[model samples]
Target: MSDLHELRIERHIAAPVDVVWRAWVDHQAEWFCPRPWRASVEVSELRPGGRSVVVMHGPAGEEMRHEGVYLEVVTGERIVSTDAFTAGWRPAGPFLVRIDEFAADGAGTRYAAVARHWTAEARDQHAAMGFEAGWGAAADQLEEVVRRLVAGG
Candidate 1:
């Protein structure tokens, strides 16, 4: 009955929210994405109403930016934003709204990210485009960082 459908992936990191947040929003972006062909996440603004950009730098020195505006931001808790295919939120193509939530637990920190699609077709398209695999790979990288930092590495 809902117009939107969501897909999510979560990981429990062995670090506090701040540490995990930094890793997630900062360092990991440089090495995130499922494949080497994709660009690394470039810029991020961690405040409400701020803007973020992810630039995919090509081997041939070409650049592509994925820009978005933050819809909501709660320090150490959540971030909701919409991303466009091009730079500066100009939207070279369709856009996706994402919700990222974080919580502190005995396991350390619980981090979850959800992508909402306007239709089933969009969702299916994303799946075909490697949504799970890409996000999953990124999460795996984050997990390694969180564990290392928490363990005093």
Candidate 2:
């Protein structure tokens, strides 16, 4: 294992853990990216060792496809995914591992996302790419989707 770098962001969503998790798993396309960028899930398996693929389409029609595997999954609690290995644990160019966690917070849910990189340089590059603002905006979009789902919209 080499030295790792991390970037984390936390938010309070006005919905229950189950609701938030549902939005995360079911409505990902609606909030996976910030405004002017859209995401579509080509494949999503909510289980350990399963494959997950998401394509983000930019405003100018550029597409970024993320292919990864789920390392761990705890229904309604946590999800860990990594690009270090693809489905079936095949080795790939290491990038980052992401952990998405949801916990009960009073009448709402406390949501957090942690992205661990293989090097400090990668972490700094992500920061320079506006990771905080981009991820924060995505979080806000996620909350909106969750709220709508919880409200039966």
Candidate 3:
């Protein structure tokens, strides 16, 4: 994947890995998008070849549904999914493969979300689509969710 065009958001959050992972996988709807935007998860099986469907709702009453299949999954550690194929191995227009990783960093967590594009053009398209700003904001939201999880909510 080194040669693939990539975009990523990395953070050293002041929260435990368990809390971060829980917030990301278990509490996705609460923090999957930036403020003013919301996400609805239709299917999140968290296993290899499982379904991963999420519909993002924009503040302007727009909805963008992302449907994909999980390529690999390692609970509390890594998740790799791609929209190139949906559940049941049906092909679709490919864009990028999303990889999410979490690791313990002392008492905190090291988190990274990466998007590997099929081509430079696709990568540029995603960049132009506000990937950095949008993803960064979502990461901030994830931290907020982590806070709630840590506080036993």
Candidate 4:
């Protein structure tokens, strides 16, 4: 991960690693995007070269579809996907590689999400798009989702 081309949002979540891992992948739609922007996973194959499409719906009927392929998926640990390719390894407009990691921390978990861009300009583009605030708020929502999951909701 290059400091000049990566944006990250990490947090210490008060939940077990498995719970956080589920929220990060299995129940992604619940907290994938910030509020006012809901997400729906169209496909989640969870394997190397598997397709993963998450469509984010804006409050005003706008839709931002993120279509990509999983480069790697480690059960209960991490997910690495990239928009540089869609399903079947076909090329697409390159954006970033998205990495979500969960590690056991005492009785809780440490979660980190990174957006690795191809260039400094792309990194700056994401930062200009309120990456910190948006991703940070989404992280908070993720924690809430984990809590709800633990409560058997």
Candidate 5:
């Protein structure tokens, strides 16, 4: 795919990698979507070829379900998931592969998300669908969740 088929967003979270990772995997429902849109994970298996299903509920009670499989999972470091395939290597309609990385940065963690689309047109469509604003807002919410968790909330 071309470079235009990828979208990336990074954030410096004021928490450790473990803290951030926990928020990502354990507390995803708390911060997965931007405000006014809640996310619920119907299934989550943090291992290669594992299945994951998440539903995002909008303010107006609209729901969008995303189903995918984990391509790679590394504790406290990285997670790669894709909608291009499901568990057991079953082929599915192509959407995007998302890579989430976390690492130590100063006393905090540096987190990044890279979303790769199958086609540049899809990437552009995602961007037009608020990829930057929506994802960026979700990341900010994630940082808040991690910070609160680390603070013993």
Candidate 6:
């Protein structure tokens, strides 16, 4: 563990806070990568100290889960959570994720995501795990979802 690691992705979505929040929190929506690695966010509550579970279905339809507890939650602003997947979500490692941070800019929302790791090696692992492409695709998808939803598509 190198002690510091972070991955950043930002974008401007032409939608209000409620729309953006739904795009992020909605589980039935297609929100993951690999074209078929579908994702679902099972957030029991949207507040600090709440529990969130994320499920991903692989190409083989194998399900993987990531569970965590919210450390902080500022409605329509930000969310910080610690991934406890290996213990409950599924047989996986740990991850710290901070996302949904937002700001009002013009008629839309400025959204940012920061993913942290324990060490440089872990960060490298994420990079090798398709961090850029995966996150980039997800970000794009999120923007599109919000845009379409807000536009009443």
* Candidate 1 structure lDDT: 0.75
lDDT of 6 at 145: 81
Q: Write the per-residue lDDT of candidate 1 for residues 1-153, one digit (tens) a residue.
A: 246777789988778899888777667554456446455655666776677777776667777777877778888899888874333445545547898889998858888988898778888888888888888887787777777777777
Candidate 3: pairs in clash? none
Least well predicted 10-residue stretch by lDDT in candidate 6 = 84-93
Question: Where does candidate 1 have its weakest 10-residue lDDT segment?
Answer: 84-93
Candidate 2 structure quality by residue, lDDT tens digits, 1-153: 236699989998988899999999999999999989999999999899999999999999999989899999999999999989877888988778999999999989999998899899988888899999999999999999998998898
- Candidate 3 on 29-103: residue-level lDDT in tens? 888888798999999988899998999999999999999999988988999999999989999999999999999
Candidate 5 stretches greater than 4 Å from native: 1-4
Q: Each candidate's lDDT (Cα)? A: 0.75, 0.92, 0.91, 0.90, 0.91, 0.72
Error of 4 at 62 (Å): 0.5
Task: Count clashes in each candidate, considering only residues at least 3 apart in sequence or on different chains.
Answer: 1, 0, 0, 0, 0, 1
lDDT of 6 by residue, 30-103 (tens): 65554558877665566676777778788887998767777778777887777744224353457656555877
Question: Candidate 3 at residue 63, lDDT?
Answer: 98
Q: What is the lDDT of residue 117 in candidate 1?
A: 84
Please list the residue runs of candidate 2 whose C-alpha ends up more than 4 Å from where it truly belongs after superposition.
1-4
TM-score of each model, paired residue for residue: 0.80, 0.95, 0.95, 0.95, 0.95, 0.82
**Error of model 1, residue 153, in angstroms:** 4.6
Which ranges in model 4 have alpha carbons more than 4 Å from their true place? Answer: 1-4
TM-score of 2: 0.95
lDDT value, residue 34 of candidate 6:
41
Q: Which pairs of residues collide in candidate 2?
A: none
What digit string (tens of lDDT, one per residue) describes model 5 on residues 57-141?
9999999988899989999999999988776778899889999999999989999998999888899999999999999999999
